[model samples]
Target: MHEWVRRGVGTVAVVLAIVSSAFATPQSLPQTILPGVGSTSWEIRNDGGTDGGPFAGVCDGSPAFGFDDATSASGAGDAYDGAWSVWINGNPFVAPGGLVDVTGTTLLAGPVAMSGLNVWLQYFFSTTHQAARILVILQNPSPVAANVTVQVPINFGSDSNTTVGHTSSGDTTVTTADRWVVTSDGGRATRSIPQSFMDQVLPRWSQQVIRRRCSTVLLETVSVRHSTFRCRARAPARSCFLPASAISPVRAIRLQEQ
Candidate 1:
């Protein structure tokens, strides 16, 4: 297995990810109970770019890593179910949405120097009556923030097979392209994909980093729990169901037919 390494620059450190071994499966990330949990696996050091600038690395050691939110699954343990690793600039970005497409010859970031290998990227996404949340986990030891984007496919699936998912918005055309960023402030950084973007895309989406490459640190996982409660009248009690109040008697009240 290729071991990812962090080489420091002026102040920013470039993630030197070693190519992943063929046997490396999606199970490699950390397991947690939260709906979506993950980790970035790379050795840390200090020697590529400065603390405030960009840096690059030799993509021959290990795969850099990122995380995606869960749709059907919940907690860190469920992250491996439908995860896929997408490469941008030779770095591994785990899909937080689901299946992503990168058929183009080049990446939006640039000419990545990958070793023509495959790596596992993990992710998940979901929506309900409440707010939509996208949980992202990435490994970066640099001082500057790395810009990241996730593209989710907004297909109607069987609901409307006749219609293509892509739509046009004014001068800007909307494909399965959705985007977000992950940054470090001398510590760990967590990013949330907005609900608005999720509502606008096809059924499929991929994660992309626009400008920089990241190395593995530790696997980071994210989970979202939403609940709504309604108040109801108390029923006739075998025992008193309500709390004792100064205005009410101490004895349990029995209902009588009028």
Candidate 2:
């Protein structure tokens, strides 16, 4: 049943209406809640595309800028859905072992250049570090070096007046290209992307950029193979916040594709 769905978590909210859908009826829905190893959890909606996922935080933290359960929302960290690329048969491979792999084999009925590029996601909770990890398995099931553009729609929302890339306070200044660190706040949550592993995939990967506006920070990674986005929240830890504005209650950081 393709219909309009309006979902919200905390102060972040959105209204969505889909023209086409993969599930013909409510009973056909695959799964709604995805659980982590421990307290980590995710409430997701089935729509072929990574449309709905209400993630509060890694454990007890709140959603970053806001909730990212919009049409094609790739909310990572604490946004819409974590990290996802392509799918097979207009659906995702939802495995409950804390590990998920989805292939992008959906063929849109249209004239497209690179059609049916295989892409999937490996979402799981790291028992060692106690964090949430998403590994986007982007591969061309077809032989030969095929150059295609993939969208791994991982969305994230930060607190008010929060910043991305670089944020400075007092004599301390922190600059990074991987994760999201808010300016300053009482319950500010900071997430850092796996920049150390960039060199491993730079030869095949394309571009990576993180954007934030109003109350959300969206990260998009353009690559060829696979990209891993990791997130962990530390309670009572120093989070991000902006100047003048009161400390935001929450902010989530996610790594995704464009």
Candidate 3:
């Protein structure tokens, strides 16, 4: 099913205080929200040489960046579809090293070369509705099948959690390498926020996490019999704005590849 997803990357806890013989009792730090372009306009372009081979693309969908749901060239059309190597800035995310494709292995996998990547973060500032969620997508270009896992620390009140598993197995096709997977582990965290808390802070509350950085990563994991391989890419950090942007309410985000 085509699902509309809302997602953001953030840190789990706040370091409110320090303790020393000369210092006072440590105070609890407050939670933070990371900002992202919910559904604002964004795009990316893949580099050369890496063109003919398979690729992947991820994005927060559009009334802005519309997907060709019926077009075969679109990464959104199928698991392995389209060429993706673009940037939200409209410039190529130039490959740091050369593009290396990983093939044939039970013991080896890529550190595949990828560039022109983009990150989208979304947050819901209101307390009245259930519009809070996070989504992540990974684009793989290697001919060899790739496995991936994403990890994040989620903190709600006194609880802390980590991503220990995956939501689904990756999608790989011979013709293309567009993959979308979710966290099967710690994906949801909600606390019973009181009206008193909301009333006190809603008017003055800023959804932005001021002091700490909040971010998430999309990772790749490979199994090599007795040994397993894992690779991860971190998304850029941003502030989570309040009252949410009305311009584009991120319904979905996709990672595109060719």
Error of 3 at 85 (Å): 23
Off by over 4 Å in 2: 1-38, 48-114, 141-143, 159-161, 165-199, 203-258
Model 3 residue 109 lDDT score: 12
Show where candidate 1 strays beyond 4 Å: 1-132, 143-258
| Model 3, span 174-211: residue lDDT tens | 11111222221133311111100011012111122212
Compare the candidates by TM-score and give the number of the best one: 2
The residue-by-residue lDDT of candidate 2 on 140-216, one tens digit each, is 33433343332232333233322333323222233332222332222332342221111112111232221221111
Residue 246 displacement (Å), model 2 = 33
Candidate no. 1 TM-score: 0.22
Candidate with better lDDT, 1 vs 2: 2
TM-score list, all predictions: 0.22, 0.35, 0.20
Q: lDDT of model 2 at residue 244?
A: 9
